[model samples]
Target: MRISVVIPAHNEEAYLPRALGAVAAQTLKPLEVIVVDNASTDRTREVAEAHGARVVLCARKGVAFARQAGLLAARGEWVAMTDADSLPTERWLERLTARAGGAVALYGPLRFYGVSPFEATLSEQGYRAFLNLMALLGRPNLAGANMMLLKEAALWVGGFPEVEAREDVLLGWRLRRLGPVRYVPEALVLTSARRLQGGWGPFLLRQVRNLLGDPRGYFGEGGERER
Candidate 1:
C-alpha cells in the first residue's frame, strides 16, 4: 500500500527532527511525508524541509485542522497518522501493511520512550488489552500517534471531526461502521512521556472521560486544545 505519513506539529522544532528521522528510517518507505506547520513562529517548516518532508502550511493552528490539512494533501491510498513527539519503529509501516488486508483502519499500541523496556512492554500490553475491549464495544481506540487508515474511507466518513478532543476515536468509530478496524499489536511506536510527566492521574482521568464518551469533559473547552 502506498502510505503517506502525516505529523501535525506546532512549534515542535526540538521534537520534529527525531520524528522525521524515524520516518526516514522506516523499512517500508512512504509515498510522502507531510508535516503540517500549525502557525508556529518557530522553525518547524524549515526543520521539516531539511528532513525532506513536504511541508504543508496550516495557519489554522489547531491539531484537528492540521491533521485534516495533511490528510487532504496526502497523495497515497493510506494515511499513517503520528504525532510530532512520536518515534515509530522501523517496521511500523511494514507491519501495518502486512496485516492490512481489508481492514478500514489499523492501529497499534504505543509506549513511552523514557520508560524501561519492561515498563514499555507493560504499557503496550495494557494498551492492547484496552484496545481489545474497546473493539468489543465497537469503539476502536485509534490514537493519532499510531494509526493508519484508507484515505478514501476516512474522507467518506467526513474526515476527522472539527472537535479538539477524541477526534481520533471518533474517526475510528465512524470508520468501523464501514468495515473492520483492527488492532495490530506488533506494529509499535515509542512516544514521549511528556504528557504523563505531570502525573498519570490527570492523564488517565482525561482518557477515562473520553472512553466514557465525554471528550467535552476535560479537554473540550480551553484545556489542552493541541494534540
Candidate 2:
C-alpha cells in the first residue's frame, strides 16, 4: 500500500533534519512526505523542502490543523503521522505495513532519543510500557509520532480533531469505530525528549491527566503555541 508520511513542525529547525533523515533511510519508503509548517518562525519550511518533503503552510498554527492540512494534501491510500522531532526506525514503515493486514489504524511505541540515558529509560521506556499496558486495558493509547491509518478512514472520521491535546487518541477512538486499530510492537519511532524538559513529575502528571481523558487539565487553551 502506498503511504504518505505527514510531519507537523513548529520551529523545529533543530530536530527536523534527523526526522527527515530517518524517513529517507526507511526500508519501505513512503510515496510522499508532507511537512506542515505551523507558523514556524524558524526555517522549518526550508528544512522540509531541502529534505524533499512537500511543505504545507498552516497559518492557523496547531498540530491538529497541520495534521489535517497534510491529510488533505496526501495522495496515498495510507497516511502516516509523525512529528518533526521524531525519528522513525529503519524498519518502521515495513513493520507497520506487514502488521497492518486489514486493520484500519496501526500505532507503535516511541522511544526518546538525544537524551540522558537515565532520563530516556525512565521517561521514554517507561511511557512505552505504559502505552502497552493501556492498550491491554482497551484504552486508546495511540500516538501521532508513530501511527498510520487508512486515508479513507481518516477522512470518514473528519480527520484529526482541532483540539491540541489528545487529538491522536481521539482519532484512534473514532477510527476504531470503523474497523480494528492494532498496535505493532516492532514498529518504532524515536522522538525528542524536549517535552520532558520541565521534570518527570510534571510530565507524568500530565500523562495521567490525559489518560483520564482530560487533555485540557495540563495544556491549557491547546494550540500549536502550547507545546
Query: Which candidate ranks first by TM-score, i.e. highest?
Result: 1
User: How good is model 1 by TM-score?
Assistant: 0.91
- List model 1 lDDT by residue over 81-182, tens digit each: 999999999999999999899999999998888877887777677777887777777768899999999999999887887777677887787788789999
lDDT of 1: 0.87
Q: How does candidate 2 score on lDDT?
A: 0.84
Enumerate clash totals for all models, in the order shown: 0, 0
Q: List the residue pairs that clash in candidate 1.
A: none
Best by lDDT: 1
Model 1: residue 25 alpha-carbon error in angstroms: 1.0
TM-score of each: 0.91, 0.91
Give the total clashing residue pairs for model 2: 0
